[model samples]
Target: MNTIGHTIKAARERRNLTKEELAQKLRVGTHTVEKYESGEQIPSNQTILKLSTVLDIPTSELLKKQNI
Candidate 1:
């Protein structure tokens, strides 16, 4: 099963967004974005919402575990 990190990374890549760009939009450090993509950390609900908006994906998509 794909973790949230994997989902986030895929979505971000689909949008052609860099980690730094995503971090800047989220008001976070690039390392934090890295952690999120690495499954070392999980973003809060607010952050998830921001990510959905920034990535142009549905929040439900972000919350769902994908089959990688």
Candidate 2:
């Protein structure tokens, strides 16, 4: 299964959003977003909720295991 980082990266790309743009929306640093996409860091529950809203995807979808 694809990791959460890959899922987040794919979702962000599908929405045509840059890491900086998403970071702005999430009120976090660009590096933090980069870490998230790289699987070097995992977002907190609150951040996950924010990501779902920002990405316009369901939280369950974001949390779901993806076939790699």
Residues 15-49 of candidate 1 have per-residue lDDT tens digits of: 99999999999999999999999988899889999
**Residue-pair clashes per candidate, as listed?**
0, 0
Candidate 1 local accuracy as lDDT? 0.91
Clashing pairs in 2: none
Candidate 1 wrong stretches, greater than 4 Å: 66-68
Worst 10 residues of 1 by lDDT: 59-68
Off by over 4 Å in 2: 66-68
lDDT of model number 2: 0.90
